[model samples]
Target: MPSVRRALISVSDKTGLIELAQGLTALNIPILATSGTARFLASQGIPFTEVSEYTGFPEILQGRVKTLHPYLHGGILAPRDAESEAELRKYGIAPIDLVVVNLYPFVETIAHPEVSLAEAIEQIDIGGVALLRAAAKNFASVTVLTDPADYAMVLQQLQDRGEVGEETRLRLAQKAFAYTAFYDIHIASYLHSQHAPGTFPDPLLLAFSQMQSLRYGENPHQRAALYRSPLPPAPAIVNARQLHGKELSFNNIFDLDAARALLQEFPERPTAVVIKHTNPCGVAQGETLCAAYCRARDTDPMSAFGGIVGVNRPVDLETAQEMGAMFLEAILAPDFTPEALHLLRKKRNLRLLTLPLEQQPTTSPWELRHISGGVLLQESDGPGVDPSSWRVVSARQPTAAEMEALLFAWKVVKHVKSNAIVLAHAGQTIGIGAGQMSRVDAVQIACMKAVLPTAGAVMASDAFFPFRDSIDRAAEAGVRAVIQPGGSRRDAEVIEAADAHGMAMVFTGRRHFKH
Candidate 1:
């Protein structure tokens, strides 16, 4: 590869522009820059030929037509072969060895709630994208850079080798393509969201940036990676900061997400949930963080072993000390006290992640699941059922204490898998049966799994009973009240069974099937 002789520099974000341009100039590499970039270079006392001057045509259309000329792109797109070199010389087009450009801030501009469509369109970036694509396409002869972070490395390489390596050029080309793709996706998403609200587009464009490569997927044999949406960071598992311990595994991320989702259901108080295989083994709310964690863990201590724990409140010293007693895989929390971090760091293998509690969205607008040949998209099942909308379908209405427990169980059952059954008393779960095939089996499993006494416990089911057998089973297990979305064909028989057992049954009129 020939040494870098000439470069084109234009960027909206001037993060490392000066240093890059200065380094190139020190190496006797001339620069061709747009009007705005030329002004910056002039201020820095760096010599550069303006793009219009190089092309011998004045910039038209409010500076938008400056770098769109053939002189610029012809140089960037020309190959180093004899025929291409002759054509470039015939047009007086010098070969551009480097193209450093970052597109306009379209993503940042549209993020403002008051940004107008015209304003967003103005920031769409035409010339910059074209320059990057042209250079990336001719990467065999040209080097392209879209990220400022690459400036120092590229400069170092140029200083050391007199030109960028082929491998580095290919990598930069890949990054440049990805940058343009991400930019286009954001623009299309914004326009579609504005013009075709509440409707899915024919061609769905999704963009994600890799956050990390996991050691393995669900099984050790499968490969996996973690990617996050291109939008601004939010308080979420993907945005969480890892404060301690080993790298998070694929299953650890799944269980942590489940734990976080369950904690979101009870944000009004300090709540804790223990998750295993993306299902809650235990969940509870208490006056203190420690109490909540202890209650949630004790709900099913056997299943809580090495499970992920999520807390709504910041982890305190007492809570961390309590957690130290168990061999937990990971812990997710809003924050952690300094003392707590010191104490928890003792468990060197436990993953600790923290996401702030402020401004967390109650539910995401959409959830996506991948299938064999297609993808499934739907609205998230959240914001929960309103207690005022619940109807008393049984002869008896739940008392105040029973209603509290029933509501708690209802909140928990929504997070459980389909055919889910949860038994609760006070503010803590007593037993939970999830992902069962039969509703009656879920009830029976809930009873059999109970470490705490099931007597006086209230029951909550993810969906209505298909028959009266589930109600009879719950009644026999000493459940005093039940909450479920009653839309079954056998609703009458189920209600009759609840009435016969003197159990207060409330119909939420909304089902939460988490399959």
Candidate 2:
């Protein structure tokens, strides 16, 4: 490839601009920069020619039309063939060997709570995108850069070999294309969301940045990587910081996310939950973190082994000591005390992740699932639980204690798989049955899985029971109260069965089916 003879620079993010320009100038490469970049370079004592001076036309439209001229695009898009060379000379265009540009902060501008649509529209970049696409298209002869971190590497290569290699140029071109696509996707999504708030667009566009390549996928033979959404960072597993432990596996990430989702249900209280294979084995809330963890684990100690643990509050020394007794795969929390960290660090292979404590957990507007042919999207279940919407269906009303346990079980059952049933006493779950084929089978499994006594335990079902068999089974297991989304065609039969068994039942009128 030919050495870089001239470069064009127009960027909204000016990080490392001066240093890159100086390096290029040191190598005897002339630079043509737009007015903003030229002003910055001139102030920093770096020499560069302004774009208007080279194009022989003043910038119009408040600097928006600065780099959209043919003189600039022609230079960047020209190939290294005789025909292209003749056309370049015919138009008095000097070939541009490098293009460095970063788009305006459209994402950042829209992130503000009170930003107007006109303000966001003004930040949607046109000239920068055009320049990047033109240079990236001619990667055989041009090197395009959209990231500041690449400046040093490109500069080093030029200093060593006096020219950028084809491989590096190709990679940079790919990155530039991705950068522009990401920018455009965000702009389109924002505009569509504003125009039609609760409806899906005809052609959906999603953009994600790869966070890491996992050692393997759910299985050893499959390949996998983790990607983060393009939206602003939030307190989620994707944005969590790993303080100690070996690299996380794909299963560990999945279990940790399940634990985090459950923990989000009880943000105001000190809670701990144990998860196994994306299902909650035990969940409990207590006045203290250690007590909560112990109670949660004690609910089903057999299933708690090698499980992922999530805590709503910071881990203290007491909780860490209690956790150290178990062979846990990972733990996710907001923060950890120094003493707690010191104790937990002894388990070298245990993954410890921390999220931002100041921000509450947030749910995405949509839930997406992938199928064989395409994808499915729907509204998120929620971050809210309103017991006031429930109606007492059975003749007997639940006591305050039973009501509390019923609500606790209801929250936990939402996170469980389909055909889910949870048995709870006090504020801790005593037995859980998830992903069963039948509701009666789930009830029986909950009874059999109980480590604590099931007598007086309240039960929660993710959906209505189609028949009275589930109610009979739960009553046989000593359940005193039940909460479910009551929508079955045989609702009268189910309610009569509950009344006959002396069980207090509440209908939420909302089903939570997780498949």
Candidate 2 lDDT, 1-515, residue by residue in tens = 87899999999899999889999999999999998899999999999999999999999988778899899999999888899999999989999999999999999899886999999999999999999999999999999999999999999999999999999999999999999999999999999989998898778888899999999999999999999885633567888899999899999999998887788788777899999999999999999999999999999999999999999899999999999998999999999999999999999999999976446756787888999998999998976799999999999999999999999999999999999999999999999999999999999999999999999999999999999999999888899999999999999999999999999999999999999
Off by over 4 Å in 2: none
The reply for model 1, stretches above 4 Å from the true place, is none
Report the error of model 2 at residue 509, Å: 0.6
Give per-residue CA lDDT, model 1, range 161-269, as digits (tens).
8999999999999999999999999989899989997687668888889988999999999999999875643456888889999999999999888887777778688
Q: For model 1, which pairs clash?
A: none
TM-score quality measure for candidate 1: 0.96
Instruction: Tell me how far the alpha carbon of residue 349 in candidate 1 is from the true structure, in angstroms, after superposition.
Output: 1.3
- lDDT, candidate 1, at 77: 86
State model 2's lDDT: 0.93
Backbone clash total for model 2 is: 0
On the 0 to 100 scale, the lDDT of residue 482 in model 2 is 96
